[model samples]
Target: MDIWKLGAIIWLFKSHVEGRAGIGKFLTSFVDNERKPTTVVFHGICWNNSVKLHVMKELSKAGIRSSQSMSKRTSLIDHTVLLLADLNCTGTDELIINASCIAQATQRELHRLPYRWLVLSDAPRSGRSSLWDPFLVDSELVLATVDGAGYTMTEVYKPSPTSPAILTPRGTFQHVLTDTRPHRELFRRRRDLMGVPLTITNTIQESNSSIYHLLQEDSLELEHDLISKNSYTLAKVAFLTLNATPVATFTNSFGYLQNGQWTGVIKELLEYNADIGTNVGMSQSRLKQVMFLDPLDNGRARFIFRQPALSVTANIFSLPFSPDVWIATGLSSFVAGVAYYLSTRLIKTRAEKGTVRDAYLLTMSALSQQGCEVQPRHVSARIVLWVVFTSMMALYAAYGANIVVLLQAPSTSVNSLATLAKSKLALGAADVNYNHFLFRASSDPVRNDIAKRVNSDKGPKAFYGLTEGVEKIRKGLFAFHSVVEPVYRQIDRTFQEKEKCDLMELDYIGYAAFHVPGSKKSPYLELLRVTFKRLREVGIKSAVNFRFEARRPSCKESIAMFSSVGITEMRPVLIFMAYGVALSVAVTAAELLVFHANRYRLRQRRVAVQLGRI
Candidate 1:
């Protein structure tokens, strides 16, 4: 019986050992096949206490071993997972736990497994660092903190892995802590001892499938790390607005609120950085940056950095799309008028009076001698003045003739109407001028006879000798017409030598008219008002009139005239005074006229009633 009992116990022991070895082999094969060796280490911590125990049991049962003791030796796990810490965690715990996990998971024989680590803090705050820190320093591992700590890796860590060892002050741990002349020196030293090159992986689980897969496996910790990194990046965006009131809000990668118009914000962002980064495509970046954030809000918010290529193209093309007639012609006319006025005034005052001494005066006197009065100077200067004027006029006329000869005056050319008539040049076959002349001649026999005599087929015969006599010039044919004072003065320079062909001064028929933009005030309007008043005082009637005369004798002749008899010209000096008077008079006169007419009619009815008493 004793021998049998011993045999049973030995047999059971052998079976248990063999079973454990089989499980170990299976676990090693599974880990090797599923989890490839990579620079990044990921781990998961179950939040439920029961779940944590179950996970540990499962790991042990699978023959995966846990470290027995902490050591400064490089042989250890590079990352770690701490489970079942309470949800209420502090910012410091978050930072420390993340750092420790990163160190443990990265531990290895090869260059200390690259010093990077990650912590899975399933609860809000777990004594993650308190539990993991001991393991981290013992293994001579570098750490990384991942949490909502609102701090960067460089801010909370004493030593950054990027610095040199000589500059780094030796501390109880591998990292350094020191106070150098330059504050950065301490940081630089710490960085050297503890810093490790790290690449951040921001996980994004946008779909339920991805989330389900992550929750099902231990590697789901990767998703959490990605989300943390993504959140951190989003927090860096700046906010701005045009008005004090919030128009709209935009979220950056860090989820910060920016208020303003989208276009404005995008423009500002573009000026800062041309490229946004790798995650967002150019089109998506443009949509995020250029599109309106809060379209329904009163204030608009936008992301400014990226803009559509079409928008840029449209902006460039839109600049030259406005009406610019003012610059092309209106402004030109205004400038030209001002220049001409200034030049004419300067010539009249300086050159004409000074250099051309008495030349103008002589011409005026000559005009007066020919029946147009020289008023205010007749008997006072008489004979002596006449003699000096006459001699000067002759000299001036001779000078003009010499200049004309040198320039080959238009009157001598075939282009001249008078020259063509004398040569009896056949007018162009279908010329309107020829038909018009024939029609006029046929309609008026007396005029036709005169025209025929004057237009005889002769070689350079004078049509009419230069004489101071008024004559009626045919329409579209004759060079001179009835004389009017203003017209005569205007044309005198052109026809001084040929009095018979000179245009005569007739009664003022029309005034120069100008049109201005109906919606806006113009400087020209003011000048026109001033000028019209001066002209009216000189007996120039500017009322609208239409003259109708027969082109042929058989046609009827008629004229219709309409005058602005009630409209008074406004004087420059009395603009304000005149405006007031005109308004009052117009209103008062209308009222008085209506009232008086009514009273008169009433009186007549009353008189008729008294007579009807019989």
Candidate 2:
């Protein structure tokens, strides 16, 4: 047998023998026998009932004995076991306090003789705040609470109350307070006895008494709303099979499913004004059901919802002029201006001999051969006219062309203002044009279209990218194009680029009285109307501001004039003047060199011819 068991048996024998033998004789017998010290188990008694008698019988059979006696000091038991009885006088809290004191004493004398302590309770209450302290103080002490008769014994121990609580070998303390409230006076006495800070938490019902009505009313209101909103089909079906009563029905019906569906159902019930008791039960059932349900597949759902769409007619209408066209037009104007200025100056200075006309004609022919048309009568006039005409035409053409070019530019081609504002489309990576499109297309019809597109995909699995509306575009993954410019500069730039896109001024149509009015002083509102007027004043003949070909009517008269200049004195005069200027220059250089050579050659030739030295 185990040493402890043997010790217990010896202790039982001694106790029984001592009861029959007197104390002095028992001591003398023990010394004469030279027996080792025996272990004893101690138990607290309450009314010494039949249950206690039965327990005593069981201990006696196990070679363990129990005793209780009033003494000045604590009793000496090699091994002490404290058993508690279910009695009304000594409440659960008081019983726990006394057990705590006994356990503390056992701990102090741990080194003296190996000893074991056991605490057994029948029908012990739970949820007492300080019930866990004794178990926490010692690990070797075994504590148990068993259900006896119609009552359950709930054991609990907490190492620290301020921190997260853990269950000890004993059950939870919170179970203790379910039936009875701890007496405040009893807690005070225990605090005095144990020299520890111990407190009992009052029931939640006792606190918040005044505004409880408001909470109830709110709960009722929420419940109604939830019932109206919840999918009632499932709940109704589940409620039918177990329809013994609403509570029993739901509990029995939903007890087997996964927690998620249960949680959802409980949540729905709560929203519909169900009582707290029902809500709690449903919630617990739902939680259990959820634990059994398959883990959610968020990754797969995201993949399915995030597929990209190809857009067909994005911002084709709002296309800007290409950048290359702007560069070409500007360069051509500058080059033409320089050429006309130099050619006309040369022709004018030599025109006094009437050869100027011929030179002018020749220049016109040369230009005509090169596919350019001359329109003025005089060479200088033609030069000035061509310069002014070309510059003006290039400026206007470039403006219109630039607008088109910007609209068609690679940066703008992937998406346009209307497309960006109207459709769910993404901009290119690192595109600066997105900002311009956003600002300019604010009133475009496409804005509504984009909004609708985004709304359709609204969910956890929605794909958000630049191809979608600019505002709804996702960040980090999606790229957007933006332009940085002074606020005023964007206005000018937009106007310059608008013509190429063939955009017309948008009229500010007043909506019905019920519709909100747009700002009358809006800069965008001004931009549309103001540009129309400006273009008209600048000789652009458009029925509406953006009517194509109206402002670009071919000038037949000018072409005819150029052709006439080629046939008139202009061409012949240009040839003669070229010859005369070449002759004059050649003669001048020849005359100077001939004069020097004549003087030297005449002297040498005369001497040679006369002397016949050769």
> Each prediction's Cα lDDT score?
0.29, 0.32
The 10-residue segment of model 2 with minimum total lDDT is 297-306
Whose TM-score is greatest here?
Answer: 2
Q: Encode model 2's per-residue lDDT on 213-277: one tens digit a residue.
A: 22232322211112111112112222222221122112111122344333223333323322111
Worst 10 residues of 1 by lDDT: 295-304
True-vs-predicted CA distance for residue 265, candidate 2, Å = 5.1
Going through the candidates in the order shown, the clash numbers are 38, 60
Q: Candidate 1 local accuracy as lDDT?
A: 0.29
TM-score of each: 0.15, 0.20
lDDT of 2: 0.32
Shift of residue 237 alpha carbon in model 2, Å: 26
Off by over 4 Å in 2: 1-295, 299-332, 348-421, 424-614
